[model samples]
Target chain A: MSHANLLSPPSSIPPKTALSLSQKAPLILAASPTSSLPWPLSLLFSRESPESWTIHENLFLSSLRTGDDKSARLTLDRMTTRFGADNERIIALRGIYEEALANTPAELEKVFQGYEKILREDPTNLSIRKRRVAILKSLGRPADAITALTVLLENSPTDVEAWAELSELYASQGLWAQAIYSLEEVLLVMPNAWSAHAQLATLYYLSTPSNITTLSLSLRYFCRSIELNDTYLRGYYGLKLVSQKLLPLLSDSTSLKRNNDEEEAGPPPKLATVKKLEELATSKLAEIVRQYNAGKTGWTGLDEAEVIAAKALLDHGGIER
Target chain B: MAQPIVQTIHRDPALFWWILLPITVVMVLTGILRHYAMILLQTAPKKQALPQIRQQRSLVRGINLRTHAKVLPPASFQARKAYMVSAYQEGKFLADPESRGKPRPNPMSDPAAMEGMMGMMKGNMAMMVPQTLIMGWINAFFSGFVIMKLPFPLTPQFKSMLQSGVGTRDLDVRWVSSLSWYFLTLFGLQPVYNFILGSNNSATQSTQQMAANPGAGLMGPEQDPDKLFLSESENLEVLEYKWVLEGIEDRLVIKFGL
Candidate 1:
């Protein structure tokens, strides 16, 4: 049973058996260039604990098998330092990273940071800057976000959204002058910002010193809002209140007869529009109430005034305030 | 050539520490940290409406009257503030941008629109029913406690002031009632965000103009009235409840944007 005797016995063993053993041993012991280790040892140590690269390789292989590009890329990133930048694997990894950026907040933040770092290297990356602004705003840094947004707006003044956010930031701080300035800029660039016009009307009404002129501006914005969007509620709401304010004048015009000097002035022009608005307000209020009762809870911000306004239409037909 | 857009950036840890300490202190004192999100939403300026509205005013009224409502209240400042705070807690605040901003939809006016609005509102309410009910009970209980813990003797002047706005009984109950109403508003955030904030499918193009020119006027050069009016329901703005309620009609009808 000694080792030397066993070796010596190989020569004494059958010639056919020895030859077959030698041939088979060489065939099994052949090394693979692609394999990390020899095949036979690898098989023998199949249950052996794997290194990080082994585990990563296995994960990557499995991911490829499953056709999970994201998982595969992630495994590659884990294997390669700095995400395999400028390497063949980068394209695959970037796609996965971008995808992850959209689905998860944490991932998106990471991407933003990464993109920002890239921007530092290359400032002309408009795409990255654009995404950065959105993410920043979502992250709740309106002021800083505005700064980023302004970068895009400086070259493209017609950018409606930039104008709007700027206006919004100003308006939020009750900075009427700044908001108006911003709004005016928007109009200059896009001219069709009816919603902005309506906002301007609201601004005029809230910030204007005189209630009458302010009311007029309010009516103007309301009319514009309505004109722009006949179906929109803000315009109607404005029309309702504005009409109410002008109801006394409109009703007086209506009451004047043909014999009366006012009526003789061609049916008192403004009265027709006022009456139409009044009717619209009444019917609309009724409809809203019906909808609300039907489980159409309109929206969440109604204070007493809105409720009362709605109720007024629901209860009383258009009556002069 | 562009003067290096990022002229200087100091990522100084010392500077960060200095800035952070004061912010943390201020945040702690104001309880802002706890409710920073809500406060930011409340404080953030709402979106500017499209420009189709101005032309519409000119067309309809023969004068470009702004089509935005002036959110005013009959009550004094003190009463108004109190009402708003209470309303905010009650979740009745309805400042969704769809209905509040310029070029707002007149849900109550047109019969067809009313029907459509009703359908939309019901969907919104249905979505919010659970949240509304839960928040209502919770707010109601807290409101009751706040009312009950009235330090009558400690601040006679303040108590009298609160009573003076209206009858004591009515005024005392109003705060609690407002809290209950706020539950309705809490659920509106999602719809508004969806319709307004997420209006543009393409993020790059949606705010391209806004990004290029901060503080651009609402009325752009094109002044495409048709586009402004009856525009496709693409991008909408997210409005805060307080701002919406600031200039409300006597009858408030909120329409969730999404």
Candidate 2:
């Protein structure tokens, strides 16, 4: 989900939502529950709920993301006061705190060493381990980051987030098979994850088009993705792409018999089915484009770039395929 | 139809002021106290070494695959099941691999096992201490009196409990003794605790009873990891595969009305 739709601030800063989010930090901090007073006094005045701390945490990150370091520090100090500095999540926020402030590679290395020290004392600190990986990636050491992630996954194989991150890292290095494997692991853990299904379809599209099985496999996944969430833009976009690729191949195969040769691996989809899917995808894409462009209340959350891309695809396909 | 004559008991009104009200108030207060005591005694989960984590999650991974394997294709499911079954049988994911094929250590000797038991022990202490004290308090001071009556009819078998201290075999079962009231308040105050604290309060006696069971939690120290993995592997090996994407193209076409 896009942050824009949730915040939906009337202030139109489409390009730099992070800046707008950080700008709200002062207002957020002022109204948040206070923990500076002694226990009894704080208890009397505080209206603390679990969500208040989550807001503070998100605001802290947004401030850091937009380089509003002073506000970030203020939010951090407030949180540290509320939940003691020794708290695990507070500890991770502190690491991110240091990482954002470091200007040079040397200072970043020092921050890296600090994370290492924390990990050495507590190797099972999963969040800190993830921070170490993020820092390594930012320090231009993708290889080291992958190794760190592999170690983390070795410990916690069921961590869906880590698997997704490893897939991204592998995809960045053009290791398509590893990326697909990691993504499949993510799908295994969360079978109904529509976004992961869309992502896997995207990966299959990127990795290989010539393989006969992958085209049908990608089609099935895109179909599953849309089946899971009919309104998912990426799923519809992928379905449109796959059908476009399959149209020419399926057209000339009428004289040739549809082979039932592949027994264990699933049979390739029929041409008539492919054509129907293609038409469905095109019409759906057009509807989504029209609905999202209408600026209705619920449709405001669609990614502007994606809706524009869908519009372009529809226009281009009318000319070519 | 014959109407049954309703028996009546006239007790001192002072009994309502002193014994009945105080017992009810004390029971409610102790429930609130138990809730806070439980919160104070709960220890945060301690961190374990990487190998230990791998041992735990590897089992979780196997179980998840078995349950959710229907989502994957037959060939992919076969590959994963084959690999997991082989790895589990080999004891490759064991936290202490040297202990493979050996019997699990006795719970008394394992410190980790001892720690889990200690946590349960603390909860039991919280529950049992208040219970004994309150029962003893009621028996010592407020025995041999009938303070309150139930509005509904009860079976005659309750006469043993409802008239325990009164030494009356012929008294109506409608008359309730102080000990019986203590017992009633003990079991029946759960809703009051739920109202005072939230619904998920630890003061509820049912949850304490649940926590006392040996096999209460998944993958607790009561069960060894090696056996858990082996059984999970067997379960995965026997699991039938079905692809969720089976004939999905037809479904999509029908869904979109193409």
Candidate 3:
């Protein structure tokens, strides 16, 4: 059982490591001549289980991500043989493969045209439509991408991934309000997404320049994000930043009065409460950095960039006004 | 005469090899064939126009909002609910604005609905035709002989059915004809199908029959999606929103000992 468990896909493998592993898969598969035997005989003679297909799929996607087009093509051929070329998932994979193979802008345009042709034949092929949007975005056409995404969302409003993508596209163009709205739409579909909440808070913070009301709203969302996922270092970091920004403003009565006059303003926290939350963020972040730097077990999951950022923030004695 | 003694007709041991084995093997093979036949016969889902897709998905979006409303704050949730309610009432997302307030087309007469019915009929036929052919084949080739005895007793009511071909008047009810053996294998080969074909195979008739009912499987092409969306919007309107993140800070404090 332990051996079987070990042979299963390693859930802890980082994406980068997984990509490299998948890139090597074709070589491994080629080395073993028996790996390509017809499925029925392989099932009877070898220890091949259903998990092999999943591994192949992962290999296909990773190969594409790493720009190993040859491995990706081989993986796609294997998948198409197994599942048939007409299979919906296989068709989507083929589209992704073509997208990966397109090197030049003209090639990308060809892929985009191919997607449009498929979409005309079957309007419900949302995957193909999404690829088309990605091609447009890559082609330096944000306006066209926005229009395509909007049309897609109008048809499939509950697609959280599309909503998140639309939010990013909006954010890239400095359309903060539209980005925030799209992110809220994503939250509507998946409410407990703490990462999304933190993302939304970041958008809110970026939209305004030291506005007390926006900062207070950002602080609440950050708190909500950390509340949902207690170990979200980014959420904690946002909370510390917002609380610090709000602390100075809360102490000044004129700024507090100005915040109260704003319509739709989130309720500002008390000065003592903000101070306590800031202290909590500081201590938690310090502990995380110390443990992670010590190479302690269970703390290695913290992103290195985030820890460095937190360390730098602590060293700076918080963001100077 | 007093009550007659129950007479047992002993069947040949070769009956197991010839009659029982052939029937069981044929039943299993036919089941495997039927599963593949159904797979081959399945039609790909047809695409809908943009407006139609929008109309259906808008309703689903409303339902999702209602169900997952706890994930959003009160203000955001209220804003969404208000927008959805008004949109639904206004028929803003209707696929064909001209069809608004008109009577729904009859599911039987509609060509798309006819296609849906045909698909169901095909599935049922795939399940039924082979079964009848195999049963007839068994009756023709392997009849008028007692094949096996049941391990358990059956009441006299089953005597007529289980001993269909064999006509010995006073034979024990447990002494069943080859037809009964065919019936047993027909019902009992489900586990074998599961072993060979994997679970969720179309070879299993009971599950397939249950799924063949109009409302059981994926939304068939026959049903009016507009009506579905309208009803879903009504459901959404009555939902009471409660924010799950309310007092989340306290829970976090308790969890992390902050």
Query: Which candidate's DockQ is highest?
Result: 2
Please list the residue runs of candidate 3 whose C-alpha ends up more than 4 Å from where it truly belongs after superposition.
A1-15, A27-54, A80-95, A258-266, A317-321, B1-9, B152-174, B213-229, B232-238
Compose the digit string of candidate 1's lDDT tens values, residues A215-235. 544665565565555555555
Each prediction's Cα lDDT score?
0.44, 0.83, 0.78
What TM-score against the true fold does each predicted structure earn? 0.31, 0.88, 0.85
Q: List, residue by residue over A65-88, the lDDT tens digit for candidate 2.
A: 888999999999999977898888
User: lDDT tens digits, residues A52-161, model 3?
Assistant: 77777777776667677788788888778767986767888898888788889999999888888888787888888888898999899999999999999988898998
True interface contacts retained by model 3: 0.59
* Cα lDDT of model 2 by residue, B1-258, tens digit: 878877677788999999999999998889888887887898876667789889889988998899899777676778889999999999999999898878878889988767877988899888889898988988899989988888887899988877777788777898989989888888898888888666778886687666555433667766788898999998987887788988898998898777
Tens digit of per-residue lDDT, candidate 1, span B91-137: 23222323433463444675644554454444344335544554455
Number of the top candidate by lDDT?
Answer: 2
What is candidate 1's CA lDDT for residue B95?
Answer: 22
Q: State how far residue A11 of model 1 sits from its true place (Å).
A: 85
Docking class of 1: incorrect
DockQ for each model:
0.01, 0.66, 0.44
Give the deviation of candidate 2 from the true structure as CA RMSD. Answer: 3.9
> Which candidate model has the greater DockQ, 1 or 2?
2
